[model samples]
Target chain A: MAISEPIVLPHATDEVRLARTWAQPRGFWGWFMNVHHTAIGVRFMVTSFIFFLLGGVLAAMIRLQLSRPENHAIGPDLYNQIFTIHGSTMIFLFAVPMMFQGFGVYVVPLICGTRNIAFPRLNAFSYYIYVVGGLLLWVGLFLKTGADAGWFAYTPLSGPQFTPGKRSDFWAQMITFTEVSALGVAICLATTILRQRAPGMTLNRMPIILWEKLVLSFMVIFAMPAVMVVSSMLLMDRTINTQFFNPANGGDVLLYQHLFWFFGHPEVYIIFLPGAAIVSTLVPVFARRHIFGHLAIVTSVVATGFLGFGVWVHHMFATGIPQMSASFFTAATLMIVLPTAVQFYCWIATIWNGRLQMKLPMLWVFGFFFVFLIGGLSGVMLASVPVDWQVHDTFFVVAHFHYVLIGGALFPMFAGLYYWVPKITGRMMNDLLGKVHFWLFFIGFNMTFFTMHFLGLRGMPRRVYTYPPEMHWGGLNMLASVGALFMAAGLIVFIVNFFQSKARGTLAGPNPWAAGSLEWATSSPPPDYNFTELFTVNGREPLWDNAPNQPIVSGVRDDIPEVLITNSLDSEPQHKDEMPGASIWPFLTSITVSIAFIWSIFSPWGIAYGAIPVVITLIGWLWPRGHSPAPRQPALEGRWSK
Target chain B: MAELEHTVRKGEAPALIWWCMFGGPFAWACDLGFSYVLEQHTCSTGHHYVLHVITVVCAIIALTGLAAGMAAYKRVPEEANDHGVRPMDRTHFQILFGMVFSIAFTIVIIAEAVPRWILHPCQ
Candidate 1:
C-alpha cells in the first residue's frame, strides 16, 4: 500500500501557539492542577525517593539496635514500630510507586508515541492520594504511635482484644490509600498499552519493556483486590466490632494469612517484572543487537504473572496444612523458576552474541545478575516444605527477599536512571560518580544481606530487638550494621551525583545512547507536546531503520489536547481521543475520598456522607468543557520575562 | 470532545486468553475453598468416603475448567495478539498470550490438584 504524502507544516506561529496551549500554567494553583503525565511521573519519583530515604533511616535504627547482643539502642516495643514502618514505607511508598506507577506513567506514553496518558486526571489524582498516604503514616510515627503489627498485620494479635490503638488503624488505612493509587494507575496503564499504540506499531513491534509493563498492569488489577479486601476486613474488625478475624467469634486467623499472601505472592512479580523489563530494554541497547527471544520473554513474563497466583499457598507452608495441599504449593513455587531462568539465559545469550559495550548501565546489569541469582537460589530452598519449616520466620527468609528486591528492583532502577537521565534531565550524569555508586552499592548490599542466611541458620530470628549474650550472634549482627552504613554511603554518593549532574552535568542532545526506541526520537527533555510531529513506526527499531526520514504522522489537531488511538493487534489508525486538560477537580476529588477513608476509622457511616462531595467533584472533573481555540502566543511573547 | 465519538474499543480477545489469565486462580481458589469446607464437614462427622468423593470432585472440576480453556485455545486465530498487519494477525498477541497462560495454568491446576490426589483430607 502507498503511503500518503506528509501533511504540510503549519509554520512557526502554529508551533509556538501549540506549545503555549499545552504548557502548564504558572503559580501554586497550576502546580496543584498539573495533569501532564511526565510532570506527574517526576513527582512520583521525587516523593517516593524521600520516603525511601526515610525508610532507610528507620532501617539504620533497626541495624543499630541489633548490632550486638543485649544492645539497647531501642527497646523491643519501639523496635516493633520502627521495623513495621520500615517495611511498610519501602513496599507501599517506594517500590510500587517508583517502579510501576512512576516509571510506567512516565515512559508508557512516550514509548507508545502518544502525547498523554489515557486518564491524565486520574493519573494526577493517584499521586495526591499517594502523598497523603505517606504523610498519614509518617505523621503517626512522629507522634510515637506508629503501627506495630508487622507489615502484613497478622490477625487476632492485631485484633481489638489483644492490642487496642489507632496504630493498626493508621496502617490499615494507609494500605487503603496506596493500593487505591496503585489500582487507579493499573487501569490507566492497561488501557493505554492496549489502545494507544502509534499507527504501524503492533504488539510484535512494541519494545519488550512495554510488554512487561502490560503484564504488570494486569497483575496489579487482579492481585490488588485480594489485599484491598483483607485490609478492609482488618479495619472493619477493629473499628466496627466486626468478627472477621476474631477467633472466639468463629473467625479464622488463617483466613487473613490466606488473603494477604494471595496478593502478597503476586506483589513480588508486580514489583520485579518492571525491573526485568528495564533489563530487557537496556541490555540489547548496550549489546548493540536486537533482543533475543522477544516473544519467549513476553511469554515468560505473562507466565510469571499467571503462575504467581497459584503459588501463594507456599508462603503459608508453616501453618501445618494438609500434606496434599502443601505438596501442591511446593510444586507451583518451584515451577516458577523456569520462566525466570529463561529470561536470565536470554539476556546472557544476547550479550554473548553481540558487540558488548561495557557502559555504566551494563555494570549494573552484571550486578543484577550476581545479586539476583543468590536471592533466587535462596528462594528455591524456601520453596521446599521441609526447608521452609526450618527457616520460616528466620533472618534467612529476610536475607532472601532483600536480595530479591534490592537486586531485582533497585539495581535496575538505577540502571534505567543512568541510561535515561540524559533524556529526562537534558544532561548526562557524571559517569565516574555513577561507577563509584554502583561498585560501592554492590559490595555493601551483598555484605549486608549475605551474612544474614548464616545468622538465620545459626538460629537468629527476625523482628527481635535484642538477643541474650549466650546466643553468640553479636559479631554477625555488628557486621550487618557495618554493611548498612556502607550502603548508606553509596546512597549518599548517588544523591550527590543526581543533583550535581542535574545542575552542571554534560549537555545531552536527543538520543544520547544511540538507542532504538521512540522516546529517543524527541529533543532532550522533549517539548510540552512531546513531538513536534509524530512518526510512523514500521519496524521494531525505527530509529535504526529509518533515522533520517522516518515517516511523519499528521492530521492530529494541534490546538487541543488530543491523541491517536489505534487497533490493538495491527496498530491501524482508529480515531482521535481528547485528553482532559489541567484541572483542580482531581485534586479536590482525592481529598474527598481521603476524608471518607480517614473518617471511616472513627465511623463507618462516613462513607454515606462522603459520597456526596466525591460525586460532585468527579462530575466536575469529567463534565465536558466545550473546546476552545488553542491559546495564541501573547502579542508580546517576551513580556512575561519582564 | 466530538472526536471521542469516533474512538473504538479493540475487538474481543479470544476466550482462551481470559480463561488462562483468570481460570487458574479461580480453580485454585475453588480447590482451596471446597477442600477446606469438605474437611470441616468430614472432621465434624466422620464419613471417609464423602471426603474422598469431595476431593475427587474438586479435582475433576478444576481439571475440567483447564481442559475447557485448552479447547478454547484450539479455535483461536493464530495471530490473536500479534502485531502482524494481515488478517491472520487478528489477535496474534492475545492468542500467544492465552497459549502461554493455558500451558502454565494446566501445570498449576494439575500441581494444585496433585495434593488432593495424594494426601488424605483432614490429615
Candidate 2:
C-alpha cells in the first residue's frame, strides 16, 4: 500500500481558529452549558471524590461507634443508615464514576487523536444526571429518610412488609439514576472508540487502555440492565403494591437476590477492570518498555468481562440455591480468577524485563498488587460454598470486598490521578507529600481491613449496630478505628497536595514521563482543541514509533467543531462529523428527568406528568439550527481518505 | 475512491471469525441459564442426567469455536515483526483472542459440569 503525503496547515492561524471553535462558554452559565469532554470528565472526578470523602466520613463514624462493644454513640437505626449509605455511596457514587466515566471521558479521545467524545452533549447530560442522583441520596440522609436496607437492599427485610416507608425507595431510585448515567456514558465511549479514532489506529494498534474501556463499556451495557430491572421491581413492589418480591403473593425473595447479584457481581469487575486498565497503561510507561503480552492482556480483559456475568450466583450460595447450581457457580467463580492472575503475571513480567521506574504512580500500583492480591485470595475462598457458608453475613465478607474495592479501585485510581494530573493541570504534584500520603493510606488500609478477617473468624457478624462486651471484639475494633483516622489524615494530605500542586507545583512539559501513548503528543493541559492537527498513528505507541513524522489528517473544517469519522475496524477515514456547540438543553433535560425520578417515589403518576416536560426539553435539545449545518462529506480520494 | 476501493477489496471478516469470538461465550451462557432453570425440574423429577446433557452440548459448541479459531489462526500467517496497523495484523489479533476465549470457556464449561456428576440436584 502506498502512503499519501501529509497535509500541512498554517499552524498559527489554524490554532487560533480551532481554539475559537472549540472553546467552552464563559462564566456561570458557561459552567452548566459546557459540553467539552474534559470539563465533564473533571466534574465526574471531582464530584465522585467528594462522594468518596463523604463515604469515608460515614466509614469513620461507623468505626468510631464499633470501636467498643455495646457503644451507644450511634443507635441501631442511625447505624443501619450509615453503613448502608456508606456502601452505596462508595460503589454507586465513587467507584464507577471515578474509575470508568471520569477516566474514560477525560482521556480516551485524547489518546485516540480526536477532538472530542462522540456525543459531547450526551456526555454532559450524564454528568448532570449523576449530580442530581448524588444530591438526592445525601439530601435523603440529612432529612433522616436515608436507605437502611443494605446496599444490595435484599427484599422481605427491605420489602413493604418488614420495613415500610421511603427509605428503600430512595436506594432503588438512586440506582436508576446512576445506572442511567452510566449506560449513557457507555454508549458515548463505545461509539467514540469505535468510530472516532484517527485514521490508521486500527483495532490492533489501539492502546490497552482503550481496549479495556471498550470492554468496560460493553460490560456496562450488558450488566446494568439487570440492576435497573431489579431496582425498578423493588420500587414498584414498595410503592405500587406490586408483588415482585412478595413471596406470599407468589413472588420469591430469592429472585431479587438472583437479579441484584447478577448485576452485582459484574458490578465488581465493572469497577475493577478500569483499575486494571490504569495498571496496564502505567506499567509499560514506568517500566520503559513496550507492554509484555499485549494480546494476552487484551484476551484476559475480555474474558474477565464474560466470566463476570457467570459468577454472580456465587454471591447466592448460602441462599439455599440448588447444590448442582451452586457448584456450577462455584466453578465459574474460580475460573474468573485465571484472567486476573494472567494480568498480574504479565505486569510482573513487564516490570522485571524492563528498566523499572519507581515513580509516585508506580508506588500506588505496587500497593494495588499487595492489597488487591489479598482481596483476590479471600474472594477465592468465598467462592467455595463451604467457606462462604461459614463466613456468610460476617465481617470476613466485608473485609474481602473492602480490600478488593479499595485496593482494586482506589489504589489504581490514585496511580492514574498522579500519572495524569500533570497532563490535566499542566503542573507536577509534590512527590514528598505524595510519599507521605501513600504510606499513611497503605498502612491504614491494611490495618483497617486485615483485622476484619479475624473478627469474622471469632464470630463478629456484619451490619450489627453493637456487639456484646463479652464477645471481646473491642481491641481489634479500636485498632481499625485508629487506622480509619490514619486513612483520613492521608486523604487530607492528598487534598492539600492536589490544591497546592494546582497553584504552585513545578511546571510539567507535555511529555513529563516521555510516555509512549498519543495523549503525551499534545501540550500539557491541552488546548480547547486537544490537537491542533489530527494525527494518524503507525503503531500502538504512536508517539514512540512515529514521532516527528506521524501522518497528519487534513480536510477537517477548522471554522466549526468538525471531527473525522473513521471505519470501525481499520479506522480508514470515511467522513467528517460536525459536533454541536455548548448548549443548556442537556442540563435542562437532566433536571426534568431528575424531577420525574424523584417525584415517582411519592406517586407513580409522577412519571406521567414528568414525561411531558422531559419530552419538551428533549425536543428543544434536538431541534436543529440552520447556522450549524453538518459538514459536507469529502471525496473518497481526498488526502484523509487515502 | 481509493480508500473505499481498498475497504471493498479487503471485504468483511469470515463468518467463522465472528463465531470463533462469540460462540464459546454464547454456549456457556446457554449452559448456565439452561442448567439453572432445569435444576428445579431435575430435583422434582429425579432426572439428574439432563444437566449433564446440557453441559455436554455446550462443551461441544465451545469446542467448535475452538476449532474455528484454530483454523483461522493457521490461515493467518504470524505477523510477529510487523507494526499492527495492517488488516492482517488486526485479523491475527482477533483470531488469537478468539482462540483464548474458546479455550477458557471450554474449561469453564467442563468445570461447571463436574459437580453435576457428583452432587444430586436435590442436595
Candidate 3:
C-alpha cells in the first residue's frame, strides 16, 4: 500500500513494452477530482447509494402518509410530491443510473480488456451532469415546489393548466439532463465494448455483461430520444404553448402516453438487463465453470433488447386503443417473457449442475429468482387484456414494477457490487454484514410489495395522495410502511459495510474468488493500462486453465504515453500506439456543454451560444500534435479505434 | 494495419449491423414521418399521400442500407468480412444516406402536400 512498495505484474507479453501510466493524480485533491473509471464508478455507486437512501426516505414518507388511509402524516400535495420524487429518484437517479451506468462504467473496460472507458472525459461529464440534475430536483423539493404530477408526470395533470409553475419544469428539464447524461454514457459504453476488447476477446468470447451493456446502450440511445423529444415538447407546451400534448389545440393526451411508455417500457429492461448481466457474470465465476450456455445467454439478451421495443404499448393497455393495437402490444409483452425465461433457465441450469458458492452475492441471486419470478409472473398477468383492465391503475401495478425493478434490478446490482468490489477496491466487504443486508432487503422488499397486490385487488388506486379509511386499505398500507423501514435499515447496513471495508477490511488478493474472467487476470485495483503485457486469451478463464506457469511481465516503461493495439477478433500483436496523457480540457468542455444545456432549457438561444465554446474545445481536443505521424496505430488492424 | 485483422466470424456480424441500422436512422425516420404527418394536417387526402411518400422513402432507405451493407460486405476483404468490419465502420451509411435524402424529400412533400392537406391554409 505504500508509494514505494513493489508493484506486482501478472501477465507478460513480448510484443509491446509494458509500463505504468496513471491517467489520474494520486494526491488528496487528485483523488477528489479523479476522472478514472474506477474512481468515477465508485463515485456513481456512492452518489447513487445516497440517493437510494433519500428515495427510500421518500418511500417511508409515502407509506406513513398512507398507513392509515388519510391519517394525514402529510398533506395530499406533499404526499404526491414525496412519492413522485421517490419514484423518479429511485428509477432515474439511483437504480438504472447507479446499477447500470455506475457498475458498467467501472467494470466493462476492465472486463473487456481495456485500460479505460472509450470516452473517459464523457464518462466524467456524465457523473457531474447527473449530479447537477439530481440536485436540481432535490433543490426544487427543498424549496417546497417539488414536482407533484407523479413520476410519469402524465399530460393534462403535468400540463401547464393543471400543474402551474416551475415544479413540473424542474421535473421535465431534469429528465432532459439525466437522459442526456445516460445517452452520453451509453455511447461511450457501447463504443468501448465494440472497440476496446483485449486481443483474442472476440464478440463471441465477450463476457455477458458486455453484451448487455452493448444492447442496453443501443436501447438507451433509441429509447431515451423519444422521452427527450416528448419532454422537450412538454416543456414547450407548458411555456411556449406548442400543441404537442395539449388536446385543445390539436394535441392529444395520448401522445404523452405513447412517447412516455415508449421510453418507459424499455427503461425497465434498460435497468433489468444490466442486473441480468451481473447475474450472468457472477454465476459463472462463482459456479467455477464457464457459463453453462454463453451463446444462449448472449442471444437471449439480444432478443430481449429487440423484443423490448415492441412491448411498450402494453403499458397503454388501459388507454382504450383499438383492440388490435392492444393485442399486438400484449402479445409483444408476452413474447418478452420468453427471453426472460431463457435466462432464468440458463441460470438455474448453471447453478443446479455446477458448484454453488453460497456466498453473499449468491444469496442475493436466490432472492432475485424468487422475487423476480413473482414480478415477472404478475407482469404476464398484466399482459392479459382482462387482468390488466382489472388492476390497471391500482397498487397491483405498482407492486408488480417494484418487484421487477427492485427485485429484478436493484438486488442484482447489489450482488454485482459485492461480487466485484474487492476486485475494484482491493478490499473485501464483511460477509456477515453482507448477509444481514441481503436478508433484511429480501424480507422487507417482499413484505412491502407483496401486500400491495392484495391492496390493489381490493381496489386501491395508485398515485392518489391519500385514501379514505373506510376503503379498508389501511392495514395493508400500514404493513407496507413497516416494510419500508426494514429496507431502509438494510440500505444503512450496506453503506457501513462499503466504507468499513475500504480502509480496514481484509485485502482481496488477485482472484480471491478463483474467478476466470479476464478482469480477474489482473491485480485487484488493476494498474493503469490494465495489463503489464496485454493478455491473449485462448480459452475462457485463461488464467485458471493456464496456471501458475503463466508468464507475468514486470516493469517496462513508466513514462512515454502509449497504447497496445491488438488484432480485433483475437488478441494478436499489433503496433504500439501512443495515447494522450491526462488533460483538463475535456472537463472544461463538459462544463461549458452543461451550461449551454441549462441555458437552452430556459432560453433557446442559450443552445446556439453554447455551441460556440463546445466547438472550440472539441477542435482543440481533436487537433493533432506535430510530434509523431501516429502515436498509436489501430491495434486490431482496422478493427477498433486507437 | 495489424490491429484490424481480427473480425468476428461470419455468424456474428449481422446482429451488430442490424442494431445500428434500425436503432439510429430507422428510428429517426419514424420520428420525422410522425412530425410530417401530424404537423400541419388533420389526416386529409394530401396528408395521407405525404405520409405514404415518406414511408416509402424510409423503407427504401432501410432496404437500400441493408443492400449496401451486403454489398459493402462483399467489398470487404474475406478476412475482414469473416470476423466483422472494424467495429467502427459499422455505421449504417445506407440508412444515413436515406435519412439525409428522406428529410429533403419530406420538406419538398410538405411544401407540396400541406397546402393540399389543408385544402387551403389561407381559408
- On TM-score, the candidate that comes out on top is 2
Query: Candidate 2: TM of chain A?
Result: 0.98
lDDT of 3 by residue, A586-607 (tens): 6667667777766765777878
**Candidate 1 chain A lowest-lDDT run of ten:** A633-642
**Candidate 3 C-alpha error for residue A352, in Å:** 1.4
Task: Put down candidate 1 lDDT per residue, A1-642, tens digits, no spaces.
Answer: 112344333432257766876787669999999999888988998999899999999999998999888988798888999999999999999999999998999888888888888899999999999998999899889888799989998887777886698888888889989998999998888888888877657667778888888889989988888888998999999988899898788999999999999999899989899899999999999999988877778778877877788788888998878766677678778888989998999999999999999999889989999999999999999998989999989999999999999989999989988988888899999989999999888888887899899999998999999999999988888889899988998899999999999999999999988898888989989887877777777567667755455456665666777676776666666566777889999899999999888888788888888888899998998787878534332221121121
- lDDT of prediction 1: 0.80
Worst 10 residues of 3 chain A by lDDT: A1-10
**TM-score for the A chain of candidate 1:** 0.96
Q: What would you estimate as the lDDT of candidate 2?
A: 0.89
Which DockQ values do the candidates obtain, in the order shown?
0.32, 0.64, 0.04
lDDT of 2 by residue, A209-278 (tens): 9999999999999999999999999999989999999878899999999889889999999999999999
The CA lDDT of each predicted structure is: 0.80, 0.89, 0.72
lDDT of 2 by residue, B1-123 (tens): 344324323534577877898889999999999998999998999887889899999999998998987876666645432246667767777777788888889998998888887888898
How well does candidate 3 score on lDDT at residue A18?
35
